[model samples]
Target: MHSHPRLPPTALEDCYSDLRTDSPLDDNSMSRLGSEMRHGVTSVSNKPKSADAFFDAWIAHVNETAVYGKESIDPTRSTSYRFIWRSWCKYLASSQEGPNAPYTMANPLLAVPVDVSRFLASGMKGSKPGRAISDVTRRRYYSVLQRIYAFCASQAWMECSPLDTLAQQDIPMAEKHTGSILTPQQWDACTRRYGNPAGNTFEIRDHAILMLLFKLGLRPEEIRALRVQDFQIGIADMPTLRILPRSGPAQERTLPLDDQSAEAIQNWKRVRKDLAVVINTNKALQADFNDDRLRAASDTLFVTRSSMELAKVPLLNLVKAHIERSCSEAGLEMPVRMGPQIVRNTRLIIWLHSGLEVDAVAVMAGLKNRKGFLHLLDYCSESVKQKIQPYRRRDDDPVSVTNMLKE
Candidate 1:
């Protein structure tokens, strides 16, 4: 729960310099650099003329110094932290005695655990009334505040982190739901509806993506990060997928592709190449599209119909949309949530039930160890249990006892 000390400005300068020297800053880094610049100017405005300006400046300072400088934090994580902090600021501004009040603006950091707890329990602005935030969200809220207060304490801005008293026990998490994994029947029904690669460009892309998730056990982000070069189809052995390291401690792993998955990818690749040529030929369309991202056209496998690299939100939307359609077509109710994860869980469960060794399954699933696969045990059916029974120790197995009395 304790926050690490902030790196000195000089240290940050050196870090940024090293990053720049290693490779050109990607869009993510450039965005962070812009925020850092804003923070540098606003950090000096400690005594801004108005309460509104003071709060803005304080928030900016927190983002620049505490959030952005942490090289270990990914861009997605950093964005989430900033968003949670901003929500807190918005809640305070709406309060009568909050920091936005003319008298209290100067002492904006004067928050206690009680205030934080209330904020966590309160309904979010756009959410339904009486629908308090979930415990998981509450825990995240506590973490953001804890980190912010720890940073404040490190700066001597506050005496201590009020969240120090808060424990994991304070927030009651929901029990893990085993039903999140799709039943075999449901999986078959859904796949039968949309797994065909003979459809149009969008259909071909969705089919390929779903195959990667359901057949290859790939996470959504992994699918998004995949480049054309990552596919090793020409190998005489077997087609393989090289998953590059991105958001986790796990090292990059290469997984052999199943026949169906390889074929689905090949079908999509043919269409993707044709689409890219068309998009690149239209100068006006190409210019308009390329203006969005800093990088030139990438070799990423999944992309928009216009051939730009696929973004996170749209990729998720594609998964959800296809799943919903498939569920409707199959005359079955869609799972409460349908995403790439359901496909991944289903695939992993199938692998386990198919009698694949746990270590081998873990490697194919891009996990570091067998321990990470333990949670998926819930998805194992009686049939799967029967399959794995031979691997389990028997209760009546003879116990090995070493004799101490040697001749």
Candidate 2:
């Protein structure tokens, strides 16, 4: 159907064709996927810089393909893909030997891997101002390029992403550090500062979210996946929130709502119901109504100001900002990463200190076993430490190391 199919497949393609065929992405043939990518697809007779031609095509492909329900990569990711592609184009324009020197290759398939590595290593900036971007950010950029190339390569547009040639070490694995657990008093202060009753609609929802994070130690995904029916108030002895397996590893568990959490959620539900009424009467809000987003948010527990389900980028910003503000107001030193994990970790620590069994806590937290709380072992008293001995990484585990801390 397109010109590029006549071109030869790379050596990797021959070896991995079976794997690609088995991939979920292969269900739609390139022709059936869309016509946008057909622009840069060249036969030997007509040549042009495929990167220039293919870039727009790639954007169209991403827009069309982000279709997985709930698990779908949404507009935030599509915006990011466009940003990275623009940056890549800027690098190409600067790297050419002369003004007329054609950008890299006529076929994007033959683009050099070193150039991609160099762009990442030199062109990006970190949040700390003067520094180059961190490895975690580098991995994100690497992921975007790999996704593009993998899809195009599947369609016979290119050999592989230039990034595939990079060494494993070039893009770092996720950083491994112990999750932080806050002091109980500091945790209580954070709750008071963030979760206190609020008159404002947005603040009421935020307050409810903060209470859940403090009490249940919920993952961000769990918060986003919550539905209206998941909040069981009259159905149970106490109001409870159901934590089900989402796109993450969190197992199914129904956690009883604390008095504060239950009240905050009840308040938020009132505001949420009020908003639906406002949209019908207020012509200004109704003027901008998005039927699709309204349908998506209809049963969702949490939503943005725009009446859409909360997205990944906004969720990160919301959680980070919430923790940072609460910590600052409570006069607690901020953790290096102010994300949901710290809140979850602190809640688990609270359970253990309150005399809950290590195995029981692990099951509640949906972790492998006591080893999931291995990092917290050093914080336990010797009596509590004995209970977790069977789950140690080694006989000389850190629970034993805590013994030496006092001696």
Candidate 3:
């Protein structure tokens, strides 16, 4: 006698089935059965949920649903979320569950409070290396775990989320690892003044990449993700490099390129064009290029030479080679492990010491706030600060300020 509406395509089959399952017995029949089975009619306790199982589901949901067709959180964030999920899952797996042989292949979902606590404690211990997992990473994991619990609770799988009660205990805050910002003298001695080893195309490109990183303060991932189209030479007739980060819901930023950076970029672009022409001489080059993009997700502005032929580890290997060769040949201090972030930190330090307005620096560095820059500011040397004081204020000399004060 009763009727129901059709389910939407997005509705789950289980939800639809639950809606459609008809009552098998009338009230009187159910009452008779209940009377017969009264002694055995106890309620079933909620089942335990494993962090591993929950994390697997969470990542799948994030990839498939959270970022599906959404431009707000770009590919970089999506990848970061994936990494965060994977790391947490590994931690949960390594940890011991509530007194039951650590849930190895046996009812991981039955994991309770102890497993969660152990994982958090272990993660905070910095047992692995290079400073314990950051507070930001821990917070992100906590949020993900909370979402997992919420999902399980919605499905009637958990009595309550472990995270709900764990809030009372304090997770130790990580000592902010201040990144060292190279002073102008340090930067010059290391980079510009050091001079390239014979100015090959490779060296030119590497220098350009270094300039972009240190001058603009771009994230490694952001730099890696940058495409050739992202570089514009003549925007507003001023030589510029526009770094469009694929991480937020914002427009692209145009950086006013210095003469050195502009020249470096031009040199690299010419080399890249020549490289492309050589590669494309082969009839199958287009197909190879597509395959390269698919494999690496690196339609990158800066790419390794013979990048099409590289295996999975080429980028890091290329970086190592560059650092070793450049430092050895130039007689400069071997850079403290060359990576994209180091250059970015270098630029932030340069701007802060030069007395660039914090907000303006943030905008140029393409940061959402001053917080990240403030962290980088911590590494500046007092000596560098003293040297940079004269460059900080553009509009007034020391004498002018003194005369104005006298009036």
Candidate 4:
């Protein structure tokens, strides 16, 4: 461990300026950044009296170590976090300039406790365009700041941390769960009406997505991350879905697919090509892409083709659209809050009542740690208890998904 007065910010400043302006540095300068960190550094910490000095160093630390719910082996997505932190720094740099300047930046590190919450809640204006992030995105932003500030406290940069000083009302609470949980009866109505698509723009794709969320309980990111090749089904074997490591909390894991869900996916794959052709030829859709990311890696199960909405908007909003349509077409009532999460919770609760051991259910639900699993305790009250039955392998029923699907 080492502790000393902060290195002059210019040392880091000049390094990045040269690297950025020069448009790629020589081997020596590259080495200096460490493989551009430790020369392959996994960890480093610098305690700065002012918060500005902490930005680059703290980013490097998270690049080396961020994990999912304190459980994933893969690090948190560094690129996205860096862009976000840069915005925070700009916000802090401009903080003292605003008429409502919250505090002096005599030492910005020291002012974190007083100013961070305000900065996050404030929406972007001008060049950035649009309103601030949604509740989901806001939680992610809070998590990123919390991670660094926690480190700041460990290095004794600030006493405790801003999060510790804020009153409960001041802190952002976990976003509320979307609407009520779906009962098996409601889900039956939703799923039963949606058979193989007859005629719709993305009917096959929509049905496949609903099956994954409602039947298999995958998160939206997990579904979006799936590749055309991730679904594996053979003549004799039941289908399985592989959830790959994605940008956010989704970690790599595979799940068993129920018979109906697998069939739904296969049906989509048959027509998936037609949609790809639309994205390829539709100038409006093609123009929306700023990069060749989707074109270059076209294997993703749910291919994204536009910035009409941001990274997640297309998928998340589509779930709401499809589920609402599904329920309406079937003449069933829609949940007050419509999102993929409600679709997922319905299926997961079904697993719980099916008597899959709680631990097994945790793994299936992608809950890597107990803290992530504890929230489910709310649905486990006594009234629900009488309905849950024991689970087992029937000697005659070799297909697990079939038995699991039997309600």
- Best candidate according to TM-score: 1
> Model 3: per-residue lDDT, tens digit, 38-136?
223233223335545555554453455532222133444455544554555554444422222332333333344444555555543343567767666
lDDT of each: 0.58, 0.60, 0.51, 0.56
- The weakest ten consecutive residues by lDDT in model 2 span 395-404
Ranking according to lDDT, highest score first: 2, 1, 4, 3
| Candidate 2 per-residue lDDT over residues 165-257, each given as its tens digit | 555445445433356776666576666666446658887888788778777878788888898789987655588888877544547878778
Error of 4 at 281 (Å): 9.3
Return the clash pairs for model 3, or none: 48-109, 49-109, 50-108, 50-109
C-alpha RMSD by candidate, in order: 18.3, 16.1, 17.7, 16.3
Which 10 successive residues of model 4 have the least lDDT summed? Answer: 392-401
- Residue 181 Cα positional deviation in candidate 4, in Å, after optimal superposition: 2.4
Determine which window of 10 residues in candidate 1 has minimal summed lDDT: 398-407
Model 2 segments more than 4 A misplaced: 1-177, 235-237, 247-250, 276-296, 392-407
Off by over 4 Å in 1: 1-134, 137-179, 193-195, 234-237, 249-251, 276-296, 374-377, 381-407
| Cα deviation of 351, candidate 2, in Å | 0.6
Candidate 3 C-alpha error for residue 124, in Å: 9.9
